[model samples]
Target chain A: MILKTNNLCKQYQHKDGLVDALNHVSFEVNEGDFVTITGASGSGKTTLLLSLAGLIHATSGEIRIKDFDVVNASDRKLSDFRRKHIGFVMQSFALIPYLTAIENVMLPLAISKFKKEQKYQKALALLKLVDLENRKNHLPSELSAGQQQRVAIARALVNSPTLILADEPTGNLDPSLSTDILNLLKKINKEEKITILMVTHSPLAAEFGNRKINLHNGCIN
Target chain B: MNIRKLVWLEFKQHKSQLISGLLAITLGIAVIVGIRSISVVSEKAVAVNLDNLGANILVLPQASNVDNYYAADIDAPTMPEEYVDRIVSSNLEGVDNLSPKLTRRVKVGTENVVLTGILPKNEITSKPMWQQSGLLGNDLKASCAPSNAVNQSNGYEDEKLQRKVIDSLGADECLLGSTISRKLKLVDGSSVIILGETFKVSRVLNETGTVDDDRIFIHLHKAQELLKIPNQVSAIEIMGCCNAISDGLLSKLRNVLPDTRITTIGQIVATQIQTNKMMNKVSLIFLIIIIFVGGISIGNFMWANINERRKEIGMLRMIGFNKATIYQMILAKAFVLGIIGGIIGYILGTAAGVWLGPELAGLPVQPIPSLILISLCISIGVSLLGSILPAYLAGRIDPFKNMQEV
Candidate 1:
């Protein structure tokens, strides 16, 4: 198994009362598995992904990713683990607007001890994998929506992370572009044997995954 | 691909937003440097002037007009030269050294020059032990004497003319003033006739920017003989000890020479010192105000920058950059701004100081090299101090919260 969560719980303080964003959720994924989490808005789909990534603290949980304890680890250890083992793709294609496509792909390796030439080569290769080699020098603002999303995907894979956590990767694209991005993710998952845990509201995107998990009111059904 | 490159790209992209802050720091530093430079040069000029006025006390004949200390000997009525012997015998306090002058206007090659007779140090020392020991002894070496007090006491560019009061002058040799030399077209060793007597020019005195520059200095006995004034001098210059001057030296000298007009240059020096002190205080106050205003401007600029880059910061955090790195990136931008501002401010400030020093402080100003480092340090210090809080807040930004925002 590459990922596991035992009775994960996340709560929020609201003016009305305490709200449960995640309630006793538990799941596991084997290596190279493509798991898609589906839920309506406010169903804790994003919260669960954030909790697993250690971006937010969970009320109570046991999340183990390849023997690294996500919930109990210190901030430094969690950051290092994320840098070395995980790649995150956001819905809005969180690319730094000032950086070019190749530079955006190179962002995760900024803190690495890699030489400048080595880093550039690695980022160029990732951009080529995502079919953006010719457009590597184009800034994010100059790129189309699909091209921007492809650049974000290239950034996510630059570190050769073991797991890719994509939150609504195709949410901002057209139906045709969305299909292209989903097919690219599927290709990366099968060819590189990298585990993918993605959250989506679209049934079409959820179909691409081999394992599907649906959530309603913070609980898995 | 590195933190440094990242900082460069980010700063270049958003530099437009920082223009106001950069300008504020630059202007503040420029004002401070300008004021300080003028103050420094003005004080130096004042000190040089005080040094040029070597003697503090001037004892002129009662019938002479004493409008200016430098020209007090010009057109002066004669007084009995026995007054020098009288003062020496009285053994008054603060009597360091005396240079009894007998000035007369004489024609030298169609040019009217003031021929002033000055008693040389050796001449004074040649007197009887009872008179010379009391005048040129330990008191002449005291800190109050201008020649012994400052390295540039005479403000002379020529090394040989550094001492305004020379030890001796040959009876047939004379020292020409800079103006007299240039006007008469004479050089050292040139012979000039003054009142039908030929005298060799031993040396030309450097320009003092005073009446002394238009005079000729020869032995007192020679001047007295040429002018036919025996036992009479125009004025007696007394180097009163600074400590005794405060202890009623002027009143004591007045009591001894009841028929002579006694004056001291202390009043003029005091007024100039007061003006310099006021300039120093004004500059200090301006520095404080600029720091306060400039610091706020920088802090506001950094805070706004942090707020605008919330999503970008969040993205970096998601990519595994730690809080410390985030904090460092913000401060790095501020540091760069400070360096740029400091250099430009220093250049502008120096120019302004040199240009306006004469108008404001009535003295020529020169750039002080040490101020370059001082300005840079102050600029960097203010930049860092203003950005610390904003940088801390930037480090605390939550990736999840910021990324979730539209």
Candidate 2:
């Protein structure tokens, strides 16, 4: 398995009471599985994906990635794991505004143990893959929403992670642009055999995945 | 990520913020540097003055019931010759030179002048580096009287000039101070009439930037004879170890010669100390205000930088930068800024300070080490001090909250 969560749980507390975002949610993403997790708003798909990505702590139960027990790992180890093995594609496309497209793509590589020249070469290649090589010098603000998303995708793939977790990756795009992004994700999955776990509310978005799991009231079905 | 690259990225991302931190560091360093330079200048002034003054104790005759110290310039009173013998016999530590000086008030072309007596050999002990400006002391040495106190003195000792009778033992010539020479336009061979006697201006001492710079100097024997005093010397100006003359020695001197008086150089230098203290107070207040203003500018700039970098910090943390890395990044930016500012401020401050020294002293200003040291210290200090707040705020960034904002 590339990522596995056993009996995972997450809670959201309010002044009146507690809300279960994820309740005893158990799931797995095997290597090369392009899994799409679909749910309505507040159905806990985002929460579950966050927990699996190690962005947040699970209230209870275990999350393991590639034979490493992430739940038992230290903060340092988790950070290193995130930097090396996990890439996140946020709904808003978290491209640093100040950095050029290529530089933004090179960030993770910059943080890694890769040599400077190697990182540049890898980032350049990834930018080319996203068709943003010509627009590599453009700032995030200078790029269109679709181009920004492409830069973000290049950034996610620059470190060559085994698992990619994206939340609403194409939710902000038009149907045509959404299709392009979905096709790009599919191409990456087919060529690199990387596991992709995506959470989305759109059934149309879910259709691009190889398998779909529905989340309702914090339970997987 | 390697710390070096991370730090560089952080600096690059937050150039303005880093500049803010740098400004703070640079300013703090500049203040320290500027203060240090002034203190150094004062110290140099002290050295120059001490050199020209030569004798530590300056014995101006006691005025009759005069309370104002600054206005108490009186006629030269004859000191008992016996006290000189006692001071010489008392072998004290650090007692390198003792020479008597007599001040006579004279009018030269409508300008009030003061003529002082000098022993040419005393320059070596007092103004040890006096000959740096190529002023000859040949005639002064030549006209000196051998007081049965030492062996053959060096330099041209002419018998003709020594035989010019004032009260029977006066030297033929006088030396003009640099300022006095400039004021009277007297050259090396110019003749001047003073005290109804014509004396040749044998030499002019270089501008030493002391009271000596303003006076006329003559051989001791010439001063006594021209002033019509015989066998009577002015106050015994002692320049050697002050500690050697104690209460016991003073009492012994009184016992040996009851009519003679004894005073330390400390009493003579009290006015100078007061002036130094006053000037220090004024400079300190002004410099402190300037530094505080600069520090506030830095602090305000750093605070703004911290606020501006909040999102960047959040993003970095989200990307897996730990607390230590964030702190280190901020501090590194601060340090780089400080170093740059320090270098710039130091260069600017030193140039200005040296340029202004001559104007302030009314003479040529030389490069002083303490000034340079002060500037360097200020630059470094400002750099470090400026970083504290920005680094703290950067450290306080909560990645989740910050990243979620935009």
- Per-model CA lDDT versus the true structure: 0.84, 0.64
The per-prediction CA RMSD against the true structure, in angstroms, equals 11.1, 10.8
Q: How high is the DockQ of candidate 2?
A: 0.18
Q: Model 1, range A40-66, lDDT digits (tens) per residue?
A: 988989998999989999899899999
TM-score (C-alpha) between model 1 and the true structure = 0.71
Candidate 2 CAPRI category? incorrect
List, residue by residue over A1-221, the lDDT tens digit for candidate 2. Answer: 77788898888888989888889888777899999999878888877776775667778888989988877776667767877887777667877776788888887765567887888889899988989889988999999899998888888887789888888888778989999998999899999888898888888889989989898999887
Using all chains and alpha carbons, the TM-scores for the candidates as numbered come to 0.71, 0.65
**How many clashes does the backbone of model 1 have?**
0
Each candidate's DockQ: 0.35, 0.18
Error at A121, model 2, angstroms: 1.0
